[model samples]
Target chain A: MDKVGLEKHTSKQFDADLEDVRELVLAMGGLVEQQIADAVRALITGEGALGEEVVQGDTEVNRMEVEIDEECTRILARRAPQAGDLRLIIAVAKTITDLERIGDEAEKIGRMSTHLASYDRPKSAFYQIEMLGRHVREMLRDALDAFARLDSEAALRVAQQDEDVDREYEGIVRQCITYMMEDPRTIRHMLDVLWAVKALERIGDHSTNISEYVVYFVEGKDVRHIGLEAMEKEINEGAARRRGD
Target chain B: MDKVGLEKHTSKQFDADLEDVRELVLAMGGLVEQQIADAVRALITGEGALGEEVVQGDTEVNRMEVEIDEECTRILARRAPQAGDLRLIIAVAKTITDLERIGDEAEKIGRMSTHLASYDRPKSAFYQIEMLGRHVREMLRDALDAFARLDSEAALRVAQQDEDVDREYEGIVRQCITYMMEDPRTIRHMLDVLWAVKALERIGDHSTNISEYVVYFVEGKDVRHIGLEAMEKEINEGAARRRGD
Candidate 1:
């Protein structure tokens, strides 16, 4: 083939590979989000079958994670990419790990659901768990969208949303303690709920991690654990400068 | 200078930079280990002053982490190193983050110790808390040693030791619950101890993370969360094959 044809073919191959990886990541994210939603729903609705499916489905997420990792390794070895391309590969690699862990957390919630469902009537705090799940699910979606678009602002927002999940987790824990104190029989069962809620909170943390990766990929900086207020202030100041405020 | 001389000079410069980074990591590790020791000692002796010192000294570890990160960034930008050099830089960058978090956990323990010291006779299983601290402190040191020498075997061992720390933490929490039930007055104080012990367990997790990074740097593969039994089986099989057994 002519040099121009060769160059064209190589760029086409690169684009195809990038798209393949993007699809894999989005698929993995979708599966993880589904897992979290189903796990929480299973607990709230006492659906044993749904909980079992979430638990069993985690193996598939784990398998996809290994495959994605292998693909990233192969791309890095063969493409010798630099700068933005390198950042994209690293982001996908790191995000997949976070996604897989989120899957595990969902599985944990599912397993706990099987145990907690046996309770005669769950403490009213099931509503809090459901709300926490909704918040984290939204964060996961936003984080993934930010990653797909390389949007730093969206990623920052997702990170900010994590605090709400954390606060809800705290409230649930306090409520569980009150129930445990009211009746000793509630101790073992309530502890399971506590663990499950803790796992869900950690899932929110992993979503924050995904957002941090999005920020890293887009800005080439680590903005993790820095308060959302500071992040918003900086971003708002930059926008104000652009608008001559 | 001739091409050969220039190449030799550049190589020496790379080696020197690598050593500088390595030495800094070791210094950070030493401080982290000392912080763990001081935190434990404060707990055992009820030394409020020592606990305060540990909390105050954590600022140094955080500053060191930033310095190490900056150094790694400069090396990567200036040298554009490959393979082993790349791994060394990446390991240092990641290990410092783990070390800094370890420092934070130790400070948390220190703060808890101050509060516990004020309480009249720590009613819970103080012994189990001490045991948890000892096991985690040992894990932290062994992880640092493994990383310093790039010893994959040592890293694997450190990962295995984490399970021991986890079991100790479980014991402490169980004992705390019993104490809280016996005397409601001790409830809040015992909960604080539980949180501090949980922090130590988390610090052990950070040590596991460091050990996993060491393994990755040395072997170019991730084996995190893989059981020690599986690692032992792999090693035994490799040994048998080498001996033509």
Candidate 2:
């Protein structure tokens, strides 16, 4: 991990800028994590007000994204950061985009929560949705923690957790389908749950994306588009090489 | 329009690099457009082989994305592009991401096509799916064209087209629900159609994302996270200001 420490630039101001960007990213990550939690709670508890609050909070997330993007662009233009510094900026830029998107997905879930609150409680379906949401929220938290620590291994673990979330999401979908088929009257409500589950699935993907960016920032490798198996292998080999050094 | 032209850097090699990236982006765009067409055609025609081919071709699109991304990073590090040049690089980076994800969504649709082909054809549902696919494919094509020409107005039109796609998507979902409720045996097949429609809806979103990138590249304004109405207003104002200039 020490070998992968942040590269020090000659200029102190450039270093300060880099640190500032990381803090902002973490701040944004914290807000997103909260949004996910609130959205999920709103869904399970049928608390429309909490869901509405999550929806309103997304605007702040969007504003932070723009601010971070501008800062990254300014740094690129002014400092002309090389190698690791450049990768950090690129990773931060990409990460915030995913975070903002995650916020949007959470807002979608929040809106669905509001709508579902008006309907009869689908207790069994709510359990699965809550379970999947918890898994995704944990993955997101681990991804941010990985980024904060620049721990590629932690990032890899976070990426792996996505599979579990995906499985859970599929289970929820199947359950929703069963519920819908059992009673035609519950079709619309079940569809809402399905969409909410889909949103959670997407959030898992965005979390995987953020983890990929963390690997790229630290390892300077592009792990995207490659299958997960290959990515895992690459990350493991990189870890071994670091150990050898 | 001249006001939005690419900025000249002091280094000629930098100009060459920018042109090279644009060409690669256009190349990737062309491949993605074909993928969308082929995937949809497979869905409509029930040509499983065609869908499989589209799935296989995604590797090429993925390769191009990595190549273009590396080029952008290299140029940013070596040239330290400023102002419009910086924005162009950022936009290209963001655009390629959306393009790649669009390819993934198309692949998902292609996979669904293969699965649905094996199942009995849901003829009526296929009609709506085919129509929505055609509209989304066109929007994607127009989005790529707008990027190629740096045509902001064309990009705005592409963005606006997404609403129609969304409306059609909702209609298809409703139809699928009705089909499922009327016959429980068809629920599984209709779910497949529903998933395919969801993929198409997502493709529209990625297309809209690309269009927003184009507007950002040309107008130097970030239109993302802003509602479509605000985006339209902003683009119109930018166009008006350009006219005054």
Candidate 3:
């Protein structure tokens, strides 16, 4: 092939490589989202066997993280991509770490669910775990959607949910302690519920982390560890400047 | 200056940048280690005041992580380093993340310690949390030691300790359940101890992740998620081949 044609072909290939990894990330996210849903369902429905399935499902999420990471490393080494491409690679690298940890949290919930199965309950999810679980699941789904669309504004909105989740988490902890203190018979059961709730709280944090990476990818900004208000102000300001607002 | 001299001069500067970032990672690691120690001590000594200090100390660890991350990103964008240099930068980027998370776990323990303070304990670390905390602390220190020396061998050893930590964590969980079951009043306090032990277990996981990054840096192998046995065999075999053994 002529030099121009060869150059164009290589660029096309690089785009394809990037696209492939992006799809893989969404797939991984979908799997993780399911894991959380299933694990929480198991906890609520008293389906101990389903909890085991969720535990096994983690292997796939872990596999996806490693696979996505290797692809990013390969692209970085071979393409030496600069600017936006480099940031995408870095953000994907960071995002998958959060996703993997989120998977770990899901697995922990799954394990707890299995243990909670034997402890007879109302055959419905605890009110607190259900509430926290629903909020966290939504956050994870929206976080992945934002990444897929490269939507920084949506990422910010989703991240704001974390504060509510934290409040819910704290509420549950206090409530659990009250229950355990009132009746020692419920101590074992309440403790298990608390563990499930703790895992849900962590999943919320990881979802927030995923949202931060989306903003990082789209805006070329690192908003991590910064307070939510500051993160919001800077991103909005940057957007305003770009729009000549 | 001549072209060759200019090339050499730029290379020297690149090396210095890499060295600077490496030093920063160790500094960050040292700070995280101290946070864990202080947090655990607070729990054991019933020093609620110290626990608050440990929680506040986490802000410094978070700041160091962001600073280190920015430096690494600057190097990557400007240097466009290849092969070993690129690996070093990427590994540093990843290592600080685990260190930051280890700091988070310490902060969690700190928070739990503060809560446990009011419950009136024996003025000694609960035997379970104390034992588990000591083991995890050693692992963090050794993981940092391995990173400093680029000693994958040491990293492998430290990573292996994670299993023992896991077993100890399980033991403590069982023991805590027994204590809470037998004595109703101890439920609240034992639950707090459980949270502290849970945080220590996660710290072990984060320390193992740091060790995995060290292995990645030295061997250019991504040993994460692979069982420890596989990680050990590959690293040892690679060492043997390098030595023509």
Tell me the TM-score of each prediction against the true structure.
0.81, 0.95, 0.92
Docking class of 3: medium
RMSD of each: 6.4, 1.8, 5.5
Tens-place lDDT digits, model 3, residues B44-80: 8778999999999999999999899889878877877
Q: Where in model 2 is the C-alpha error above 4 Å?
A: A1-3, B1-3
RMSD of 3: 5.5
Chain A vs native chain A, TM-score per candidate: 0.90, 0.96, 0.93
lDDT of 2 at A139: 90
DockQ of 1: 0.20
Sort by DockQ, top down from the best? 2, 3, 1
Best by lDDT: 2
Between candidates 1 and 2, the one scoring higher on lDDT is 2
Model 3 lDDT tens row, A84-115: 78888888999999999999989989998999
Give the DockQ-based CAPRI class for model 1.
incorrect
Model 1, B1-245: lDDT tens digits are 00001012357877788888888999999999999999988876789899999999998998888678768766765676666566666667768877987998899889988987877655347776777788888888899888777776787788888888888888877876776676655655765676688789989988998987776666555565466777656544544554569
User: Which window of 10 residues has the lowest lDDT sum in candidate 1 chain A?
Assistant: A1-10
Q: Candidate 1 — which pairs collide? A: none
For model 1 chain B, the run of ten residues with the poorest summed lDDT: B1-10
lDDT (C-alpha) at residue A81 in model 3: 78
lDDT per residue as tens, model 2, B1-245: 53467778678888899999999999998999899889988888889999999999999999999999999999998888888888899999999998899899889888988987877766787888888888988888898888888888888899999889999999889888888788877776777778878999999999999999998988888998888888888878888888885
Off by over 4 Å in 3: A1-10, A123-125, B1-10, B123-125
